[model samples]
Target: MNKKDHSLLTRSFKNISVLFFIVVLLLLFVVILINVLFGIYTWDRLYMDLINALVGVMIPLVLFNFLYDRFTQQHKDRELSEKITETMLLDEQVIDRFSNDSKKAFIQKSTESILGKTVGNMVYDTLIQSYLSKSYQYRHHFKYYISYLGDKVTKTFAVDDETIFIFNPDDYYFVREDLSFERDITNFIQSNDVRIGFSYKESTLDGLYQRAEFMFRENLWVNEEHNSMLQELSNHEMEQFVKSFLQFTIEIDGEVVPYQVIHNEGYEGFHLLLDIPETLHSSVLSKVHIRFQMPQLRTQKKFIVMISEPTEDVEIMFMHLENEMEVEAIPFLNEAESITRLPNDTIKIDIHDWILPRAGVVFVWNDRQ
Candidate 1:
């Protein structure tokens, strides 16, 4: 037998020896008790005759046997108790080892499951259905983290940041494979109560696989963004201005980035600047295009068109000006108005000026040129 088997046999033998000794000792005690009871039953007649002659001899022998048996039994019990304790200790160690190994196996399995093809497909598909399905509507607020899907797209927006955009797929645009995008959308239902939900769509899949993939990751529809928008817009006095629509354009090195517009809303006369994904940010600033909506207001002719980076540092060249005034209203005409340089490159163009009460200004950003 192997060394391990031999050791196991030896341990078993020791336990068996302890048990045998305990049994033998217990049997001797039962025999002694039976003999004492029998002797007591005949004590008057038998012991009376034999007591005088054998009592002295019998007493010493009986005492010696009793003492010897008691010590032997105690020794056997101690050995058995020690062996039992040792076996228990060994069993506990084995149990602990098994528990730890099982836990490790479970952790490995769980990790594989989360990243597995089936689970990924399921998550992606659910997200898509939540948006495209007629059961729910997504409005102004949208959110998502792109890196979780290996750097897809990430964007966060308030309700007031809404802009509308249109796209023409046949135009010159950069396309890359293996890109996936996810978003949580909020919109109002016909009942006036705002409904919130999650949806995800990816760019890689060909044809209908695209729609099938996003339906699997749908989760509970919650109204957290609605409350946030209500509080912010009400506090800012911009509540009446309600979000119109939103659009996104991805640009890389002055080239258009091709992305399917899953949804859009509120795209009339307001100028909008939708944040393009940073992967395309550098390309945008290299040669950027500001897609702005023209104002339908009557006073729009009085105000000149000027675009400046929100952080006014260096004066970027002005794009368009109204001809109604004898003089041009140039933004960089006053150098002091320039504040600080943007840490990162960005493109800002003033499509139309903010008007007073005569013409309320609403800027909408759209992706469509």
Candidate 2:
């Protein structure tokens, strides 16, 4: 290296050191000046120290409050969900109890009168009431306008080994995949021992009437034990029925979502499991059409038998018989062996047997729906 280059490097290094010293000295001077001013103002150093310490404390405290708020919100959300589910379940029971012979004539008369006045109105009335009775709330998002493609829409209702459901002018577009509303609905129906059928309105009031007439005729003429009136169907008859009649949309954030309600018997308690998209699990609300049959009162206690998720926690609500003098206390008798894993996610439960009678079971979801 040349002497001139070495001298230039030394000078540059000296300047850098002086700048660094000035910066450090300035920062120290600011701190000292702050302390002196604070002292002159008769401020306690300990108090100031405590204030600073509190600021440090508040940083975490603020973070903790934020976390706590989130957690509390979640808890409140879960509680609200549970309440809605419970109300929906109760409404289902009320509607089911109302659908007996006692109310059948009233329903028919009202339904018939409504049908005469408007097309596809009969089924709409029934579905709306049935759903509204068991839902958080109900709103007619849109009016159904019936237009017939053919001469008449033929609907056949038949009973077989299993109960069948039929309704006209289906709003299948309301079936949403995100809400798991279908699952919630099926659970409500099964809990109440109900079944349902679905149909839709075509273009014109006449077409709606024709479809309603078909459903009414089928319901009246078909044997009470009939599964379906339509014959020559393959093994997937019920599947076909579900595909054709029941139309629904999943409700999320007050928006209607498109989905199909596929009949499922995989779970003993429920007859249908709605295959929904994963995205809808958290925000979707469900509306189910169910037909509940009152448990036969063969003895002093009404006994109902059902199968459900063995490991699942369930809540039961019973409708006290009107004439009964005293309500019987429910006794749960788990007959199955201790299982680490539930059997087929189903355990047969008897509501009234040798011990107790006339009880209903409601299943609570862990907000997965």
Please name the candidate that would achieve the greatest lDDT relative to the true structure.
Answer: 2
lDDT, candidates in the order shown? 0.33, 0.36
**Tens digits of lDDT, candidate 2, 101-189:** 54545454556565774643656464444544453222212111111111123334343545344323221011111111122333332
Q: What would the per-residue lDDT of candidate 1 be over residues 1-369, giving only the tens digit for each residue?
A: 999999999999999999999999999778666766877534465457567768668888999999999999999999997785466446766435556446444434444467785765564455333433434322111111111011222222344455322222222111111111122211111222211112211111112222312211211111334324323333223212223212333333445633222222221111112323345422212333212111112222222222111222222222221121122323333323322222222123222222111111111222322
TM-score of each: 0.18, 0.21
Worst 10 residues of 2 by lDDT: 212-221
lDDT of 1 at 15: 100
Using TM-score, give the best candidate's number: 2
Give the count of colliding residue pairs in each prediction: 34, 47
